[model samples]
Target: ACKKILISQRYRLQAMSLIHESLSYSTTYEKVDMSQYIKGIANNIQKYTHHTIVLDLEPCVLGMSDAMNLGLFLNEAISNASEHAYAKEVKGRIEVSLKYREEQCVLRIKDFGRGFDTNRSSHSLGLVLMEDISNFFNEGNMMIDFEEGTEIVFSFTQKKNT
Candidate 1:
């Protein structure tokens, strides 16, 4: 099972790496202040179309190790929403939140848009990749709420940098 997960993640990471490479110049960074940059990204996306972007950031913080994990976690979540949420002329509402749970950290990104069938959602390349990445992140749980709107929640713990 672990091998399967790793293989899936490897494929997804390969695609992400290629996408990162194709960009002539990159705007995103490896590490960032959650409050500062999160808001910036929301503002930029909000500018293009009339979408309600919210940054529900908490004062809680994490170390570089944990932060990096959360960054990738959030990146994948937001990227998924940005790519496939299909809002037509208006952009979807995206909400990013960070909070510490005991010794762990939880980061969540939610999108209000067209929802997909969880059971029917094809274990496409992206979903497979997300599953693999979620496994590596330690107790990281993901769920898709497919009622009125689409919401993807990812909750995980952070390991401190040595």
Candidate 2:
């Protein structure tokens, strides 16, 4: 009983951390096409897995980081999650969401399946590569939530003047 309670609490904390990190950017906003933008993201992720793919990208101009930054961010995180989080014949789901704030863009990539340990996960090259991207945004938002599933998000400044 105690173990179950601890696990539940851990999940809850992770969820809050993911949501919070995705929203902490203080910057400007611009336009982004969800489908086209996802192409770069999908390619990066696919390279890391040999399984089927599923994607649901919201249709709208998501205020996002520069095209390059956004691409790299999704590529590394999704690929890492795909490789480490999925199992044989146990398909996977990747969800990408972009929320436009008046002055910034919040990007989120979530996966379905058992999540990972953020602390121990940092040693992995995927997470390291993802962290390396952090220097680009002094105030950017990024997070990895490890609960029932995994959710990673990054908030970045708008690419163009609004």
Candidate 3:
């Protein structure tokens, strides 16, 4: 129970840190450079997991709310991958990519470790929260593939600026 509480606190801290970093780098405080935001997240996760994280991020900007929601979604997904995907003594590789094209964004997180049963995790709080976050995006959709490891793909259309 204590360990679970510590992990929960750590996750909250990570979310706060990401928000602070995003706001610090924004000029208008309404938009966030997602590439930079994701890099910061990847760096933090890498340090904690000591796993190889390869990133392929395209430069993209998103509204503050969308960025925050997506960042939280990412935090949950990546944290899940790091915790559940690998063995204790094995250093695994995780790949993250964010691409924006034709007014749509696709974010992919893949881990080269043993995958878990998605059905068993469907009721987990982390997965439930991630699903909720994805709903905030315009036409947002999330898919998880367990073959060859666990790969989570989330895509959404960007909201048009009025």
Candidate 4:
């Protein structure tokens, strides 16, 4: 029972951390270079993984609020991949790509690893927080593909400046 309590408390703390990260940034809309932001996240994740991670990004303008939220989401996703996607002795590959299409931005994170069961709820706090953050974006949609490793795609239209 104590162990379960500790685990529950840990999850609560993680959820609070993600919420604080999202709220720390202002919701004001402004032009942001998303490629730079995503690249930075990929680098951070790379530091912890034995896997080789590659990024392919398109130049695009995004609102500061959206960018901040997306950053946190990507951080969670990439961190999960880095920590859980590969065995210690075996190196894997993670690919992150961003593109703009039809007035929407699509971000994809793919990893070559032993895929997980998507039909069951993920026990990771990071994943739960990611789902929460994705919902914060306007019309944000997230998809996970476990067919050939794990592929997560997040897509949302940028807000129009009045």
Give lDDT: candidate 4, residue 35: 75
Q: In model 1, which range of ten residues has the least summed lDDT?
A: 17-26
Q: Rate the local accuracy (lDDT) of all candidates.
A: 0.57, 0.59, 0.85, 0.72
Q: For each candidate, what TM-score against the reference?
A: 0.61, 0.63, 0.91, 0.76
Model 1 accuracy (lDDT, Cα): 0.57
Question: Considering TM-score, where higher is better, how would the candidates rank from best to worst?
Answer: 3, 4, 2, 1
Candidate 3 stretches with Cα past 4 Å from truth are 159-162
Which has the higher TM-score value, candidate number 1 or candidate number 3? Answer: 3
Clashing pairs in 3: none
> C-alpha displacement of 159 in model 4, angstroms?
5.1
Best of the two (2, 4) by lDDT: 4
Model 4, TM vs. native:
0.76
Residue 70, model 3, lDDT: 89
List all candidate RMSDs to the true structure. 8.1, 12.4, 2.0, 5.4
- Kindly list the per-residue Cα lDDT of model 4 for residues 1-162, writing each as its tens digit: 586446445433453353344335535325556776677666655665678999999886566667677877887777667666777688889899998877788999999888775555475676787889889887899999887789999998874332
Candidate 3 lDDT score at position 120: 93
Enumerate clash totals for all models, in the order shown: 0, 3, 0, 0
Report the candidate with higher TM-score, 2 versus 3. 3
Q: Write the per-residue lDDT of candidate 1 for residues 1-162, one digit (tens) a residue.
A: 686456435433543343334232334433335554345444544553355667787654444344444445565566556555656675667778876666465666777778665666657556665667678666788776766566767777654322
- How big is the positional error of residue 105 in model 3, measured in Å on the Cα after superposition? 0.2
Q: Which stretches of candidate 2 lie over 4 Å from their true place?
A: 1-35, 43-65, 159-162
Estimate, for each residue in 36-139, the C-alpha lDDT of model 3 and write its tens digit: 88888877777778678899998888888898888888888888888888998988888999988788899999998999876798898888988999999899
